[model samples]
Target: MSKSSHRDPLSDTQLRVKALESVLLEKGVVKQETLDAIIDNYENKVGPHIGASVVAKAWTDPDFKSRLLENASDTLAEMGLSGIEGTHVEVKENTAELHNMVVCTLCSCYPWTLLGLPPTWYKSTPYRARAVRDPRGILAEFGVKMSENVEVRVWDSNAEIRYLVLPIRPAGSEGLGEDELAELVTRDSMIGTAVVEMN
Candidate 1:
């Protein structure tokens, strides 16, 4: 497979982020190490866990789930996971009959507050165009096989509003606690590309 667009061809958002980081470094607002740590934290530690926790709570708590479904931007504040340019968020459900996929056709507009940074593939033009045109095909490429009856729903992310997919919890997970459930939620699942594996 070819390398990510980062090295071969940088996306606009990537360039902007780099420019901002450079300005901040020049002003001494943050050290290079600090910036690197923050990126590492988002890429590995904190970001995706926030979204996973939301999904896990939705799985366990019906009231929060309802509130989340109704207004994620506000409901997320209750969990202290709001802010960071997340003024609007739309939560979509992936059920037995419906499947959801997220893409940003223009830029890498995503729920950065909850999901951290978008993956390199998410910023690719090919992925952006292909996701909306053939969501099931993209899902299959991601190893998400679905039955023919499942209707695929693709949501194009933008700067003002972003989408998060609440994937269907696997069977036999009824006994799992909130933390255990959160552990099962992956970044791709919330992106609607893959389902949460029970194991």
Candidate 2:
């Protein structure tokens, strides 16, 4: 077989990305070590679990919850969770009457260290527009039917700051431990797309 036939197939976009990466590496614009570190950070070191831990702690500890609400950056730093994309973080709490959701109207400026990579929908133009324009509709589509009496607040994340939603603890979960509570926290809940359910 010829070299072309032997080569693995790659999509046009993938090939372009690989070509650009090769050119950058050849030009010394980026170091292999840096690239490896970034991949490793996203693949292993970072994820929604980090944010879930903080949420669990907040759920179990009143003081921690207060600190998280009052100063999320400082509180996250205390847990050694501070880094790029997390320098300026804000935590919004969900209560009986108040509901909060976060969206990046400009771009997907998310808390990468806490939430890993942003979801494809989060970066889409439709989501960016609808999140601010019709948050209740979006929530309803996600199966969250908010009562008419409940207030809905939509937060726009930007380059300067990112928002994390502190979803209300599920009923019958009061007896759960921190780790168990963390298990209950989902990435969508933190993004305010879905509420945490015990089941």
Candidate 3:
């Protein structure tokens, strides 16, 4: 028989689990339960909250915002978030001169450090394809109407650099603290589908 004929017939999920198990077994370092716990801890407790903090700090500190604009990965490390996507991150700012939007296009390649697991819409194939072609129309469907003059530039995230949107700070937040400001920075804002509005 040929080498291909001798291969196993496991499904994709089964193959992934078997591959992970093989690696863990080879390492002989930790139990499956322990590895599961580590994954759970990072996903639930560490990643999203760290990202929120960074957004909050940027809202409150102009200097930090400058640094983030210059070198996002290094600025993120200054806030104790390193090793995210191999120390590489890119910050895209949304402005009237040039609005920025992000979509995985291929898959949900997100910056989990500042924004946890991606939302359902982000992973949808429709969003990936439509976001780049008609950004303003997509945003309008999400109830965001933009001026006709504002140009929208959609970014497709790949294996190398992850993209995050720096939303324009809302008005009437002149006296808000960092924690309060962070609450305004929602996932939609980062995705450039919704703008934060102050009451």
Best by TM-score: 2
| Segments in model 3 whose C-alpha atoms lie over 4 Å from true places | 1-30
**For model 3, what is the alpha-carbon lDDT of residue 67?**
95
lDDT of 2 at 157: 82
lDDT of each: 0.87, 0.91, 0.78
Write down the worst ten-residue block by lDDT for model 3.
45-54
Model 2 residue 79 distance off true place after TM-score fit, in angstroms: 1.2
Tens digits of per-residue lDDT for model 3 on 13-37? 7777788888877898668788787
Candidate 2 has its poorest 10 consecutive residues by lDDT at: 3-12
Question: How far off is residue 148 in model 3, in Å?
Answer: 1.5
Q: Once all C-alphas are superposed, what RMSD does model 3 give against the true structure?
A: 3.6
Query: What tens-digit string does per-residue lDDT give for candidate 2 at 96-154?
Result: 99999999998788988789888899899999999999999999999999999999999
lDDT of 2 at 8: 60
For candidate 1, lDDT tens digit of each residue in 81-144? 7665566888998889999989999888888878888889989988988988988888889998
What lDDT would candidate 3 get against the real structure? 0.78
Candidate 1 is scored at a TM of 0.80
For all predictions, the C-alpha RMSD in Å is 6.4, 5.0, 3.6
lDDT, model 2: 0.91
Ten contiguous residues minimizing lDDT sum, candidate 1: 1-10
lDDT of 3 at 120: 85
